[model samples]
Target: MIKNRDIVCIANTTWFGEYTKSTVQLMSRLAKNNRVLFVEYPFTWKDTLTTFLGKQKAPVSRMLGLKSRLELINTENGSKVYNLVPPPVLPVDFIKKDQLFKPFFNLNVALYKIALRKVMKKMEVKDPIVITAYNPFYGLPLIGQLNEALNVYYCYDGIGTRRHGKRIYAIDEAFSKNVDAIVTTSDYINDDKKKFNPKSYVVKNGVDFDTFYADAKNKVHKNEQKIVGYIGSLDHRFDINTVEFAVKNMPDTLYHFTGNLRNQEIKQRLDKFDNVEFFGSVKPNDVPALLATYDVGIIPYLVNDINKNIYPLKINEYMAVGVPVVMTPFADLKDFSGMVSVAENNETFVKTLITELEKDSRSAINKRIEFAKSNSWDIKAEEFGEILNKLLENGND
Candidate 1:
């Protein structure tokens, strides 16, 4: 419904060859009808240094076409994605009461604003709709300066719960109260944001059905034992304890994890288990093939205030592939109880995994595939487009 308008999306994640997140997926869909400027997270001098030192690899030329401060990326969905590159600035993870970092923070903001303004001028975009997805520190402050028609804040997680995210939560609270519209990924987040902005709405995470829904009979690798798998970043949100407990309890089961290992300590701990295999970070196009090999899918997330609100996309991907899914008791998964098995504790998690592995029936697989079809990224994007259209029509009255 939202078409022919220029949209500027300020995302927290990089637009370069990183794993596609919700913002990337939705914005790409939106770009089919509208001109979209997808802004990547600013690259600092330290980041460049790290890349040069072989600590991190830079995105390939095919993925990012750099033109000074601007990088143009061609998306598969025919969306115009422009990545704005900000000048190097100080890195402050935490803010002090004395506001010593205020000066440098403002400088960082100015650099981003200037870079974005140049892109806007080049595109002849005036009064564009600005969508900021969980980047309060950098993006929210630019709302007034950018002369945007409307500002939307998309909250995907309760970031305050993390040790380094306390200050970010403060910014998120302020941003939530001021943004014209607020979109959240879960009910808990929607409720929390609604307290500050009544316009807040929940738009849950969805899967890419076209890619995920392959033949259920397709197998990427043959395994002697049943493969219980997880396909996502192995970050702090993951409950290593639960995975370890399940592995120990079911030694005969083969556990496969295909994603980047963010937590090296947890990776080292999980490596101790002989039954567990970690295939570090597969390509996005190759995910379905990897998933097809899984007999059962698992979401072993830690039970915390932040994670309790997560509407994971992996669950839908697993279901779309006709693989039985067993997840931890996250509140967002409650609605899918019929399709997914939610375990309350480590013991229950292991038991549920075994149960799901045993009960992988054709009828159940068909039902899962159908459910996933209903929640595809295209459908979710259409729904989101309707909301944006309605909001724009009202002119934020």
Candidate 2:
């Protein structure tokens, strides 16, 4: 048995409120028998106005900087959550912010060192097992400070190719080296991590099977012409062209999208398609219910260095709802060939959609449901629990 200790989780923000689907599901399950602490970030892009304005030496930059705090979450399972709060923007954002606004983004790496020292002091707990879902950039400097920390670096997305090039990569690389174990969202990312760390592992993303299955059990009665749908973040990773092709080629079939629109321009561009319906961000709890209305789901990620390696959470979410999914070519999704519709390009996407639409999809639906049942979050959480247990028990360090 793994003894309960102070566990701190780090992500972009605490204000985002709802935890990342995988994080919330895994932690909620882990909290059932252990004391887990989840750290939330309070600072956002807006917080960097001072940094963007090139005012690194400003009082706010110096005083409000590099501080780590904590929050508490009360779960229904009678387990307490220790949420860790960390400073948002580090040295790089400060420089970029300074270029935009005079005296705003003038922060130096030394300030990061100072701020991190303070933040580390606040997060320092006796025998802490830290599970960071993303942002290894932030974790690099703190590794040495965490006296008795068991670091579990969970890479959801590849950091080096995302935005900032060399600097972020260097930081992430250093963090990867210091961590005890690594849990990535996809096998591709695990392969990527092997270049840096020998102990990296892949734990694919999962969904709430029970909720989606319940919705699948009670099929929504709708007279509307529903052919395909997608419910996930509308980030740059999406290939709008493919989505447009799917909607425009099949003018009669209504293409439904449900999620918060991050790109307003893309949303505007998508407006040209009359058959497309945009249902903005739904609460996480309402996903299964909303997915019940869809006939099929689409993963329209562009095949690139950044997106190609991603293991999209929506794939599992859709499958759990027993909805057939069509995906673009991705190395991680190759194993799902027969089970999912794989499109090589925009034209293939449309062709595959039409083919799937024509087929008797009952077997596909059952295959998806059965696949989801075996790969539930409960099982993934247990696997994650075992990893944490081994790390703490061995305490090899």
Candidate 3:
């Protein structure tokens, strides 16, 4: 087991969010045996301004050190994580030209580097294992500056397919080449990143199986209102037509969505449906309870550029809850081909979900729970640690 190591985690996503990311869970689990410092998202000055003006709910106090910036967060199952709220950077997203963006990007890096050095010194962190999750822009400049024993880029998405793809891809490539290894959540992602760096490993995403499995036995909702639910950010990945078709056809069945709504127009479009209900956002701890209430879980993702590289965690979450899962064939789901049902189109997706909801047997539920147990966070953390340990053992340090 990888223990007693000072691990520095530089995540693209913040430690605090409505829905937990796979990176957060993996780091939390690794915290059990490691001194983990989680550096959160670097919110820009624009974000602070917006928050101060009551436009957005950004953590302005924590960002500005009005409140404690460095907090010790105790995770469930006996783990300690230091959650570091980073100082805001200058808004650089608007600068499209590479030459102009480079200077601003370098400034942001210097800003973050100075701040991080102070915290590291204060925390007495030495020769730390550096792992940046999906933010190569920040990851590139700090490559060797940390005096890091080993550098690992834990990429979860192909940023080249995202907005400002061309701009970000170049920096990401340079970062990939400099890292000791690249760990990805899907083979699809690993395949893309390996072109830049061959020292890439595909350690797929896993769920907190024990929580949902335990909750499956507890009855939450009393009413026999069969519900089809989706628990994630209703972002661009959502196949609108597929969801609309399901909501329209299954008028009697309750269609539940529980996450942050990225687009207002999705709400405008779906508001007319009486069967559809949006619970906004629920805490991670409350997810199992919510899962228990769902008769079936649907991952209605469009086969777009972004969705093509994803390995959704909600699939296993639903599986752990012992509910049947039905998703569209968006990405490479070969690993779960036999375990979960995938449909070719919207009509087939709705049909499969109906069949799943109607004939969910005790044996099937048990099988899903059992399958999910093997892919728990604990197991994935172990796999990740083993990889890190191998790198360390092979003289990467």
Best-fitting candidate, measured by lDDT?
A: 3
Ordered list by TM-score, greatest first: 3, 1, 2
Backbone N/Cα/C clashes per model: 1, 20, 0
TM-scores for candidates 1 onward, in order: 0.93, 0.82, 0.95
Compare candidates 1 and 3 on lDDT and give the better one: 3
Please provide, for model 2 over 196-260, each residue's C-alpha lDDT reduced to its tens digit, 9 standing for 90 to 100.
Answer: 88877767777777767887733423546765888787878778888887777889888887776
lDDT of 3 by residue, 289-358 (tens): 7887888888888887778898888988988888788998889878887889998988888889889877
By lDDT, the better pick of 1 and 2 is 1
Clashes counted in candidate 2 amount to 20
Q: Each candidate: what lDDT?
A: 0.79, 0.68, 0.86
Worst 10 residues of 1 by lDDT: 58-67
RMSD per candidate (Å) reads: 2.6, 5.3, 1.9
